[model samples]
Target: MNIDKPHAGNKFFLSEISFLGYVVTRGGLRPDLQKVDAVRDAPTPTSLTHVRAFLGFASYYRRFIKGFAAIARPLTNLLRKDQPLTCDGECERTFSTLKEALASAPILVRPDHGKPFILITEWQSEAISAILAQQGKDGREHVVEYASRTIPDERKNDSAPQGECYAVVWGIQHFHPYLYGQKFLLVTDHEPLLALKKLTNYTGMIGRWAVRLQEYDFDIVDRKAEKHGNADGLTRLHRPGKVPKGEEITSWKEPKQSEGLEYGQVAILPRT
Candidate 1:
């Protein structure tokens, strides 16, 4: 596996270079401009196979594309056996949007193992998304990666609390590789979720998700949805076109109180 396979994109002793279809430099990792240009220039797919091929290429750089799964969900729906392969208005709009996103995609920095991470997950009416990041030496928060997925139709009717709980579990698992073995902050706009650590197996869905999270080392923080615009990108892909009824978020209090708003904010929880 030496220069014996140079075409395979092997490199050595270079601070900045293109490796496996991405640009690597001090700034961060980004998709090769030529590849991005090809996607932007490609025409809309007219068949199932063509759609799959296009998605395969776009997925290669999904790490740099936020909410990629939700954005591509429309096209994926067309791949269903019971569904027709025709590209509709929704599919066409999604295809162009994905290309535009890739064209202007952000540069993602690699994680710093020595530093702590901040994970933000949000449920925006129709989808769930999260961003795993860390503050770099330069004092700016750098993104390790972005994740998001469309909410299934059956689950759309779920209660807001249920959705919020799911986001915490889903987000942690999605970014488990970077989050495991380190203490991190799990930011959420839902204050009720702030009590996540207090739940047990006796609780319903939230409790179950809590059990799954016991092995991880992290704390949940409450940030109002207005200020939560950071990880709110992906959910906008679905046009629920509605906002949650305004609910005031209370400031998190020190843990170990009995006010028990049932699902109010809790600053820190200790293992009993």
Candidate 2:
């Protein structure tokens, strides 16, 4: 039998048979292949609307980008109230940079429940706050998420120490629902560490804020200024103007734990 030519009278049926045989023989039968849906083209975003759309998407994933809000400040300013602006060279540059940053931004990994989560909280001011979460394993740490916010003007100058305290309290409280039933560490350099339990006497808004912090299960560890260098770097990264290079300030002092062992002791052990 000549394989290239139809076998006989039933040409159409022979062609169908040949095609089916070729498909089955060349690509082994796969149930998943049968369920494969036809590929559909994604609609292209309009250039006029792409900026806004991409920025919104970037904002949604901002926690994955260090200094995101700070980096995008120039671009965000364009959307502010009564601001006369044009998407000129500077705007276009910022827009393009942001788009590129968004495209290359890393996906945030979920925190490991079996591991202790480290939160480095920074109060750039009473209202402007930031937190960097890192997971430790086999004696190393990697960032898991970055969170930062600027308090409304009404909240600034309220009491730097108390505000920082409240920020941590509220931050943990806000993130508690997701992190409930898990062990975590809080990092801060504020002197409030000596007076955290006395928050109720703080007075004014700070006093009210302190009441909410009493419910969380956490221990406040004082990060000496020298130890908190990396965390401080993260705070400076959120400051106005260009961000500097090098490792953001981070601290690794052992947190006091129950059972007469420090949290860092267990985490620093080599993984088998």
Point to the candidate with the largest TM-score.
Answer: 1
Model 1 lDDT on a 0 to 1 scale? 0.74
Per-residue lDDT of model 1, residues 1-272, tens digit only: 44665755555778788777888888788888877887787765534445666788887777787778778888877666555334456777888998999999888987788889999998856688889988887887788888888887777887999898888888999988888998999999999988888775546766777888899999889999898887872212212223222312233345355543232111121222
The total of clashing pairs for model 2 equals 7
Which pairs of residues have clashing backbones in candidate 2?
Answer: 127-151, 229-249, 230-248, 230-249, 230-250, 231-249, 231-250
Deviation in angstroms for 47 in model 1?
1.2
Error of 1 at 204 (Å): 1.3
Instruction: State the lDDT at 3 in candidate 2.
Output: 67
Structural similarity to truth (TM-score) of each candidate: 0.76, 0.55
> In model 2, which regions exceed 4 Å deviation?
1-51, 84-107, 125-129, 132-134, 200-202, 224-272
Compared with the true structure, all predictions reach lDDT values of 0.74, 0.50
Model 1's TM-score against the true structure = 0.76
| Model 1: lowest-lDDT 10 consecutive positions | 263-272
